[model samples]
Target: MRRALPLPLGLLAALGTPLPSLAAPSVELGQVLITDEAQDELIDAGERLRETPGASNLVDMQRVGQGRVASNQDVLAYQPGVFAQSAGNDGIKLSIRGSGINRAPGAHGSGVYTMFDGLPLTGPGGTPYELFEPLWLSRAELLRGANGFDQGSLALGGAINYVTHTGYDAAPLQVRYEAGSRGYQRRHVSSGQVLGNLDYYVALTDAEYDGYQKHSSGSAKGFAANVGYRFNPNLETRFYLRYRETENELAGRLTKAQIKHHPRAANAAYLARDDSRPQPGSTWVGNKTTFFLDDDSRLEAGLVYHDFPMDLREGPMRLKVAYTDVSGTLNYLRRDTLFGHQSKTTLGWRTTKHLPNSGASQFVRNGDEFGPRSRDFSYQGSDTVLHAGNDLELAPDLWLTTGLAMIYTRRESAVSYPADGGKVSLHDWDYAPRLGLRYDIAPQLQVYGNLSRSVEPPHPWSLIWSSTVATQPIELENQTATTLELGARGDSVLGRWDLAWYYAQVRHELLAVEIVAGLPAKEANASPTVHQGIEAGLDSTLWERPGNGKLSLRQAYTFSDFHYRDDDRFGDNRLPGIPMHYYQGELRYDWPSGFYAGVNTQIASKVQVDYANSYHADAYALLGARLGWDSPKQDWQTWLDLRNLTDKRYAATVTPGYDDAGQDVARSTPGEGFAAYLGVSYSLR
Candidate 1:
């Protein structure tokens, strides 16, 4: 038996060292300690997400807005244990602590859940790609692992919620534009207003990019709006609307040799077929109502409807899909004193109904010409979940947290093609339980630990499209895991730091593997596996003065150890895809005069490409820098961002595959070369 390593106390001690006190109060500290009405009104919307007893992070858009905000990578760069690699302007491969590490580009069963505000972005079919714009968000909250139980997440990777700006928190008027290398350009306009008892916010954005690789161009246009009515101080309701249309050319992947010699070239096969995503779009509307039962209690309910249409042209196939989803949630929260200690309890229920219509056609060599129909399918799926949680202050400095979630899912599908008429159905019931404890060592320090279980049902689409059973059956077992985690987070005189260590034993873990060189990856259940990792983040103030400004260093490091457990064939080989070590760091300086400059770098270790652990992607490091100015009036801001300063040629992401007798395959997407972006924004209160 392999013994687990002990937590790194020395590393934590080093990061917890004390530093000189600032002459002025730190906004960071104020965020944690201040609870006055004025301070509460000024708090970022994501603050509540950070109060979880497990690993969680809040990204304030104000900080990220200083640089290029192009893709998910830009928004999640400083977060530990999570990796979002850009495959193209509109494609990002996301993984968290080995979750979804085996999935290929465009695949969506990653166990990670995504949301917009409180609305589910990952529908019942489990797809959340090419659906978001960073500029539209006010902040984002990442709750790792079972910490996301509050959001009805049933995945090992947890959930991320993107919170948008509201009339009360947004600028009265704003305009922003960005232009960058590779024909990148974006423009956005927004307005917010409040009248008597009503408030409204609206935004429109258009973006275009001719990617670094050939045939990788993409464009998008989006509109988002929301209106709120304050029935009274105790009750309020808001309605939201969102629409987006996107189109992109697919570049496909390349082999090691090709990546080294012609990294900017698109796959020959993809180019021949003119592979692309044509006018993929979505429309969504939703409403949320909240009622304050009392000072310590509240009730909230919300409902959302989404209509999505997508078209894709692969080498010789064209697939079109129409998806509709209706989802809703009801939640209640209460706080009371239990045995003289503070206590809080929450109850929530969520449900979603998904309807999807899909069809595929075979195409000839003639571009945009289709031959005979290949497959057609219609699917109906529904998921209902009930969850309850409680937090009890066991003592003056100790708290206990517990939660339970029960989920029921059902899927029914009908297929028609080649005279093969059939119907398939699958149903599953799953439960997740979590227990955690947290101790406050000081006003600014905390340590927490949790033991939890997670369960993820296969996506409805995966059950029909990626089945690997000999009979091609649609029934698949749920992916389940039991995890144990320990962590510490605090702000010291030196800086703010968050560190965590976790180990998980997983059964029926979902695996995506490419059996053929040119076909899409297929999904299957793998043997038992082990996932363990260390996630650490630090923000240190190296220098500070009230009038002179400040110099700060931010760093995030993730160490992942994931492998099959004595598998029948692979025999404990490392799972392919994610690197064992990844690190990102930045040194930034800000002046009282509203000027700021920062240099950042990212480094990753070599990653295994095949289950045999024989083929691998070479390690690479990227450096970048940004300089910006913010007017004291907070009305105008501008910045220049430089990326890939060294112009390193490397794979930004890779698709997992089985061993092919030691031969390398074309399954890697090359990283972008040196590029620069300039952005300017103006806002009025």
Candidate 2:
């Protein structure tokens, strides 16, 4: 075989794929060998998302802090197409692919499009999860659909940035603690530094729990900070701050026979209406700047400010909302040589607005006393975007991607209380476009394809809370999709892999039901819906023993298939609230003296809950474990986390129901049983 030659046509279609990592690395003996590492910003963002052609994910909070990193369901555990569940506190229920499937699980969170260090934090009355602390992350980036079109996110679940911690990765001082089971605890502290061209970071956190149903207790507090400067070698700037506060106590949904025999029971009209939710604080501030315009061009700018407020005491209504927002961004980047190959470009613009005192003020409660002010509203909105993108190097490793976007929207709702009460204004314009292709076919294989479009709109308090006739306001539309994707990523001998498949064609699709039964959940507009999927991932190391310990495995899988393409009474049936098969896994062991151990699993698939598919919510499996230590100069760390051992009794989430004509009724949110956790951290580098 000393005479091998000829191969192209995308490396002969990746050697006729039969799926061996996807179907398909190392260097030595040279003084020049570098894969990635500029102080490792998550391996330079996984080498800049492998030059994205479609689909992307990267989350690292230093291996998720070894374990027990609380909320956002432990920082999106095992990610692969994401689902994120937890309704027993830090409000979870996120979705991707089937985008905001049936929206429920704490206040607003819909069709994903959030960001922090990369600017904007979703506005127009949605995506508010008490400042999302997550230990003030150091990484998290997901691009997904339309590959986020250079970050001006066209919704339908795309774009999530969340990157904090500065001072080049932070570690000047730190402290941490955690405790668990049904009465958990957590606290943390931090600091960071760097001097010459300035830099800084800060953090603080708090938590409390006493929940596993019955009144489902909760509490939280937070803080985060940042600063940066560089004023030379092409300029730079940064600034940010955050604040938060929260309180929760509302345990209402349940029944699959109360999650198979009273799995922590608590709904009897929520114990005669004692439900709660309190949040008197939430804030964010931001800034970003950069400029180079030389070594191949660059420019960037951003600004943001946000405030969130709410105090809905749960049922007999005592609302008290008010929000504020403002945002702006600009970007430009370039690298050229087009005709003869090698090019890259991006241009963007963004906007968000809502102010003029944003909305709400209803009131009327009974046993806990509160009367006057029955209604008064006001909520306006705005969103603007303009985008452009390009990449080309069309042969020799092949790459081509293109994009376009244009959007402008405005929504206004008004009901200056008990008088005439009605006003709705709207304005719109939309467009999105993209195309892609990628092929490396060597360098451990890569392949990709895409075609996209996405759009979503309808918040502004969901047009008077999904109105039926409560002061008018209800005409919702604008939710579109048009996707198609194919993907692959590799590294053979069974080591690393990622695979994807997608198909969508949704046109009005905005679902959400729960007709009535203790409030909330009413969104609409659904007619032609179909969203298909499959996403797979693996990261294995199987075994190794050079200095005495190694074995690893990681996995994730998702396969949803939302329905309805023939509906006039639920004809094709199926679209009810995720779960068409989902899985997660982890198995690990590592020691070269840093110590580690793990075992984990999660499986789901039996979730219909209603849309005339007449109730469902059974299948489940969960088990977990972890043990850890890291001190090989990592300064200090510790962990031991376990959950739902064999005490299964599941149903982690579901907030559906439009026709429970078959009645088993309540609506589910149980999942949590045998738990344990412990953690510690110390640093000073």
Candidate 3:
């Protein structure tokens, strides 16, 4: 048990002490009073200042609560270059810098990485990252590109850090239930408490939706819990756990003819082949557990374990060290997929041979143990990766972060028929070194830059399975890149603004190429490629009236050109699916009484979807509105939010392929529209 400091002393002590005033030379003040408590406050403030060194965006808890983000991807959509595509709740696909858009069968890799309280939640198969429920998070910080070295893990794109709520203060309880269009409904319950030296928060959310396409209805349920204890003011420990289960029967790719017939028509055959669930009736489960320790505000350590099991797909095992204040982290991951098949028959082949059965019987019994060619087979494989690194602060303004990661992978797949047997195993290695610097130009402004290296491992789909084919594990060639960036961030009348420019050159880059429908052409490390971009953002209040009202604005924009240097297959083609431009804007008005209204808008330019640059997805925009009241004098709060106010038709997915009828077989799902939600909450302080 820990003692709670007296109210006034506790807060003041955490802020710092007031210096003694100098008295007249002749009549010096009797001894200036400086309490022991004041000394502790100074130390706390000093530690906090040293722990975090960079500008960060902290979304208001209230604003987050009002936004109905179905998945972690949704949480990133408003940010430049970040987008999440979900057929429905729990079925989410995310892309950052155009990664993961072209996931082929059997491959396990997603470029972006995610962590909670400094614990990586990314899986070995990589495609299916555990969709962290934002409800349990206190706040999140995004460190774009290599600037995210503090996350302790290795990622080339960027890092999303979710920090769970903890520490002393008040206890709050909130429960919300909302229903909307498309048969969408959800319920969330969350609570937080600070007792003695321990603090914690927990939340649970259950959501269901009857999607835009027939047979696409589904339900998603999840639970997340966090617990932390402060061992005096210098030591603390915390635990985070999450579990999610989802069932979806959804439509997949469709030919242009099918789309022309009816955009929302149900293609049962296509629906049955949803890649995420090969079987018509299937379920997917994901679980994550992480433990972390914080010491003296200068050292942090964490361990994370994740499991993703499915009824019809491979399951992956992932572990990581996502936290570090002094030294960095090490990560290890393994993934495997296995299935069982069985065949049964009542009649024997001998009967068919002796009795001279009908033509149908003869044809059916031709190859048999019950039937000619009756076969049952399954395949299994494992991918192992070990990544270790550290962020070393060599000087006050200069820091060097470096690490090495190695991966060993194996595949043993068999068809019951001895005629077809194959095995493949390969080892791959990558060394990453990162250097970053920040020079304070002034007390209010700073200049920063970084150069780093990264790699993307091969996916399971890269293995060949044809009996006649001398199948081979695609040669493991490390995909490496060098990045150079410069940025400036500070506070001003424009509110808080961040501007940056970056240029990256990559060798042996992994680029996805669409060979034909439902099949991969091959895996290859292409010629050098390059990506250059500029990112800018602003957040601030435009006007404010004392005790009356205020108007605020928030905006972000990204401009980039990502392309392959030269290639025969897709010569000088701009990498597909990554838009050249994207933007987000929000306007809000708040009254003294807690009444508020806001409008949020998001836009993305047209993007190519294939290596040949033959297919494209149209540009789109979405708008949302919110009305709420949070009274300062009351403990209760209520709000209403409406999304996709226009009910506009939009596409969320598109595949690059021509159908049997010689028509484009690309299918796009419409974004939800005119959806509204209402909820009320109360807290006891």
Q: Largest lDDT belongs to which candidate?
A: 2
lDDT of 1 by residue, 621-675 (tens): 9999999998887788999999999999999898978885577788799999999
Which 10-residue span in candidate 3 carries the lowest summed lDDT? 345-354
| Model 3 ranges off by over 4 Å | 1-61, 104-109, 166-172, 231-235, 254-263, 266-268, 272-299, 313-420, 460-473, 518-524, 655-663
Candidate 3, residues 468-521, lDDT tens digits: the string is 343323343556678888766555544545556778887876555545444333
Q: lDDT tens digits, residues 585-661, model 2?
A: 87788788888888888888788988887888988889898988888776788889898799889889888889998
Runs of candidate 1 exceeding 4 Å displacement:
1-11, 15-47, 356-366, 468-473
> Candidates' TM-scores?
0.94, 0.34, 0.73
Pick the TM-score winner. 1
Clashes per model (N, Cα, C within 3 A): 1, 1, 8
Root mean square deviation (Cα) for candidate 3 = 15.7
Estimate the TM-score for candidate 1.
0.94
